[model samples]
Target chain A: MDRSEIENLIARVALKDRAAFDQLYDRVSAKLFGVCLRVLNKRAAAEDAMQDTFVKIWKNADRYSANGLSPMTWLITIARNTSIDRLRARKKGHQDIDTPGFELIAPGLNPEQAVVAASEASRLSGCLDTLEEDRGKAIRGAYLDGETYADLADRFGVPLNTMRTWLRRGLIALRECMSQ
Target chain B: MTEQTDIPRDDDVLAAELVLGLASDKDVIDGRRRMSTDAAFAGQVVFWQERLTAMTDGIDPVKPPARVKKKLLAQVFPKTRVSVLQRVWLWQGVSMASLLFAGYLGVQLLEMNTRPGTQPTVLAAQLVSDTSGLQVLAVVEPVKHEIALRRISGEVIPNRVFELWAILPDQAPVSLGVLPDSETVRVLVPEALRSQAAQFTLAISDEPIGGSPTGAPTGAVLAAGSMTEL
Candidate 1:
């Protein structure tokens, strides 16, 4: 579904139309589930997080229009933020010891290639590619894997301050590249 | 708009940090609070979120298990007005049947108490699978640290062992033990994990023989329910 269709459905969802809510779920649940799975990294927890995401969407659909975001953007923001909250909660409970690593399983292209395809993601991918490969991967890993700065630092074998500097500079470069 | 120039300002950097999930949880919470009051900062964060989310375009979409939608629907539109009326009517019918069953159970418990034969069940959970319509009723005797599991639904897959797990909130699943196949099986809960019985949820997973080799549930969670005081 395109942006307008999703927006209209969300508007109806805000009105408590059960049919529209079902349609919204049908259109977006798979993508949102993938987002949750990547962030939570556990099937059961990801499912729970996805369920909570929809509930939040149902409750907070009215907040969408004021955000000046595309419908999918708004929906994904909710999904990502909810998963991040779950990540933080899990971390607080000291449950990170057994987080199983998941393998990315897309059909045609490898993950990085697919990410850079000339489609909706092309502009962002091109901008990210301008950064050092490690820095770009750090940004992607932070967003996709819900890694903390500390976690990224450990993964990259860099000091925490150096990781932060790399990311800050990388974000600036990405912003500059997107503007062009 | 002036802040959109080549160099990102401090607030823009903060917004980027928050959007990237690299900020500490406290910082993120403060950032959200700032976004509520600071329009320009909020817009910057949304801009970053939209652009970064586009990068996820490559992630493949996997169809969630069928029960997810079913459970979501049940939660979302729990009982329509018409269904509420139907539920009331059904409850009235079931209440009579339940009363009779409760009376019969009372008599059986009284007999057991008088005979000093059976320990009273201290805790119980009815593990129901929304996907498969499987129900396993479990009753625990705290003093003995033993739980009796009875299969309320007879649907069982051959060669797949049913493993029971205890899941505390925000914690990884701790293996309780493998459950029996056909009849009621009384399994002992390990002493170290017994204190968690009251607060945690009991879930059953379909695992290979000898249960989960890694000390965690490796199979689909077939059924789960929270323990309740009995």
Candidate 2:
């Protein structure tokens, strides 16, 4: 998908253009549905999550530029985060990830850093492999499985403190490897 | 919900934890607030979101079911264009059955080109309706076996064609044909219904571009009137 085309559609959608919104849905829904399905791991839940994702997209497209994420990243984040919210909602007293489109623009990455970050994003898979196998699984399980620190501690049979320490080290190592 | 006392809270790791949803519930809330004020923290959070999101790159796109779109459109656009305009059509007066007849009468008169008062129409009906600006004058020319119509107000809906229907006393409506987007139209009277032309009620229905596929009128009846002898 052409990044500019998606960006153009999001800009048009921000203006409340229904035709552009429709086109945008057609262009991006499959990829978003896939992301939702990966996180939710159920057909019905994923479908509902995808629906909610689009509703958010329509409501939040105007804020896309202000959030300063790539168009696809912004959208997939919504889908992923929405699906994870549903996954965690099954557990009582759970909090959702930051609502879609509300991601604060990080100041650390300049345009050049952003280019580096984009390349780093592509390095993510390799970096995951470079981490200790258990750490890699812990990261994936927390992200893809919506595992909280307590949940990870339960799953990995570590104390909650140990789980947090282990996962933080994994993230630090992964970040370092990607930067390299 | 208190900050974890495990290790010194590394901002980069905390940002990663927040993006990964590993943050404690209270931390999730606190982290989000901090991101707004601390651009560096916010930037790290965004950077992590970007990097973590690529994890789904291996997931194959799945085209959702067609019904999903159907249900979504229904949810999003609950009020159809017609209801949004609040433009109801047909029978500002007259009983329901007879009102439906005006569509039939209009169908019979649709093809004849009779000017008002040129010669007395064998039959005529003035079609008007509540919540509508539609006013059509239809007349049956007996000799030509045709119906002549003059639209005085209202309009053809964009992208929608208007259809003419003929309704007899108790029978289902029979389609005349799709009406052109013109002020005046001439429609041939169906040979079978000519005997009941005086009792015919003509109606106009809003339909798709090529008109209704089901021989009967398939859309909202916009105008209708029962025929009266000149």
Candidate 3:
């Protein structure tokens, strides 16, 4: 679904319209599920997180429009945060030791399809291309994999402070690039 | 860096760190404290979250198992659509009836206690909360391993389930399963716990639908009382 359609469905959902909620689920569940999987890195946990995310979306639909964020962004945020919460709630000593490489963006896309994917996607891709290669990768790794500074430091073979600096500067640069 | 430029810059970085999930648990808790008390800090966190979320566009979508959707629907739209207040009213009505029944049962028990021929096997307790003015009267039949719970007063938080627990002396609370939504609920005390019921306290806690996912009480203990043999 396009952005406005998703927004409209969410508006109806705020009114407790069950059909609209079902429609919204059909349209976004896969993408949200992907977000959950990427952050959690476990199928069963991701499934649980995905289910909880939708329930949270249903209960907190009223808190959405007031935030002034795009529907997809809002939805993704919920999924990501829910997954991260699940990750943190795991056993105290548990850590995701495996460092998976970032998933490459889709290889083949016509210009029409790219435009239809939402300008935010295109804009973000363009901006990420402008950052230093390793810095960009670190930012992507941190967000997509729920990697902590310690995890990134180990992956990049950098001191903890250096890893923190890379991420901090990379995020600032991203903000600047996206704003332009 | 001079202290002048450092503060806001540090806040911005902290916000970004929080949104990106890169902060340590301690830092995340501190950041959340700031978010609640500082609007600008919260907005910056939202800004970073919105910007960074776009990168997830490349992650290929995978359809979740069908059971997830089924379970989600079942939870959101349970068969009974009783509102909390309505349930409370219903429970009150049931409570009044149970009180009368308990009165009858009490008289019968008194008579049974006075009788010379047979012995009766029944145990009872009253769980009360002075702050909320909540009361629950529990009568147990050890042989049958069942406890009848009657809500005497107060109501549970809407949209959450109440789970009954057996808090044994010097032991952690053991779940007795979720209380029924109605005013009167009959719960089969778990076999392992039946013999120990009289030695433990009965408490109810507010939990998410389907009870505590962790198999333990995660919410507040709304009411509790020690069991007393009648």
Candidate 4:
């Protein structure tokens, strides 16, 4: 749905319309759930947090103000906060969260992302190819593996500052490459 | 320093590094803050967001389970109304059902053509609940004949009722009537009422379970809005 449609529905939801609220859930739950999963790093916990976030949305719908932030931003704020809350609670000792192995946690894209990917694949592919092999590895490792610059530095037997420079230069090259 | 003020080159370097996931947590945090506050930084952010935004292309699309959506819907719309009293004054009143009616009322009152030609001439003041941020009271349309009072259904406190009142210039507030329900709530604007409305206000007061004990607004004013012509 478009921004206006989402905003309109949210306004209706503020008035306690069950149908509009359901429609909003149908539209944004997948992407929002993915965000929850990313932060909590577990499926079941993410699901729980997602449900809690929606409940908050339902109760607090009347509190939304269209000052500057978009509806997605507002919704994402709630989801992120909910996931963070659950994570904090888990840190205090809930062990039921099933964190998958790193290999099993394959980078998953949702539909909006898929469309963006489909449109920009060739350009990005060419850009990724232009970076030096090691530099590309450094960037990909830090990003996809969620590793730190120090980790990349240690993994590659390089100085931390040197690793940082490589990623920086690699990104510059990639930007230039993609624009071309 | 004077020769190095042209920082697009430096910005490009920083943005690319940030996008490549090379920036420190501090770097990322500071950069995002700057992006929001600085226009130059915002442009760089848009450029980087566009470039890195494409990386999702390599990932596979994952469809979550059907139960996920069902769970979400249930969470957002829990099937429960705690009261046997199926009727209450709606508080957060910006319903889509009412917006069209408001627009029509606006046209009939103003006689001024809207949209495609009309401009937002009036600063429409819908009385908002300061705590809940809900637009509870509003001047739906200020017509020569009538003014619609738009309010939602679940706004009334269990033991309270709402009574509408119109404040007049150089005069005390005038009691309109009790808000019976959500649907039929049009208040007649006394023909002489318009000239003074700009200087006056629309208000609602909480009354007894039925209505105001005193024929005037005896309880706390729930919501109020200033009237203006556009």
| Of candidates 4 and 2, the better by DockQ | 2
Q: Which of the predicted structures, 3 or 4, would earn the higher lDDT when compared with the native?
A: 3
Per-residue CA lDDT of model 1 for A1-180, tens digit only, reads 587789898887776656789999999999999888888889888888888888877877755552345577667767776787788775553322111100001112233433333232448887788789998999888887777778998999997777787888888787777766
| Worst ten in a row by lDDT for model 3 chain B | B1-10
Lowest-sum lDDT 10-residue window in model 4 chain A: A96-105
Error of 1 at B141 (Å): 44
Residues A1-180, candidate 4: write the lDDT tens digits: 387788888887777676788788878877677767766678888788788887878878776644333466457556654665565463333222111111012222334543443344348666777789888777666444444567788999997767666677777677667655
Native contacts kept, each candidate: 0.38, 0.71, 0.47, 0.19
Each candidate's chain B TM-score? 0.49, 0.48, 0.51, 0.45
What is the DockQ for all candidates, taken in turn? 0.16, 0.36, 0.23, 0.16
Q: Ranking by lDDT, best first?
A: 2, 3, 1, 4
Kindly list the per-residue Cα lDDT of model 2 for residues A1-180, writing each as its tens digit. 788899899987776566788899899999999988888889999999888888888878877773446788888888888999998887888777748666733344566656777899999999999899999999999878887878889988988888878888888899999989
Model 2, B1-230: lDDT tens digits are 45465667688888898888877777888887887788888888888888988888888999998777676766655545334222323323333323343344555333332345534345667776775677777767677778877665677766788888899889999889998876678899988988889988899888999989888888888989898764
Q: Against the true structure, what is each candidate's TM-score? A: 0.56, 0.64, 0.54, 0.44
Candidate 3 local lDDT, A11-63, one digit each (tens): 77766666788899999999999989998889999999888888888887766
Q: What are the per-model numbers of colliding residue pairs?
A: 0, 29, 0, 7
lDDT of 3 by residue, B71-188 (tens): 9987876524223422333334543433443453445544554468855555666776767666777777544577878775666655788899988888888899988666678788
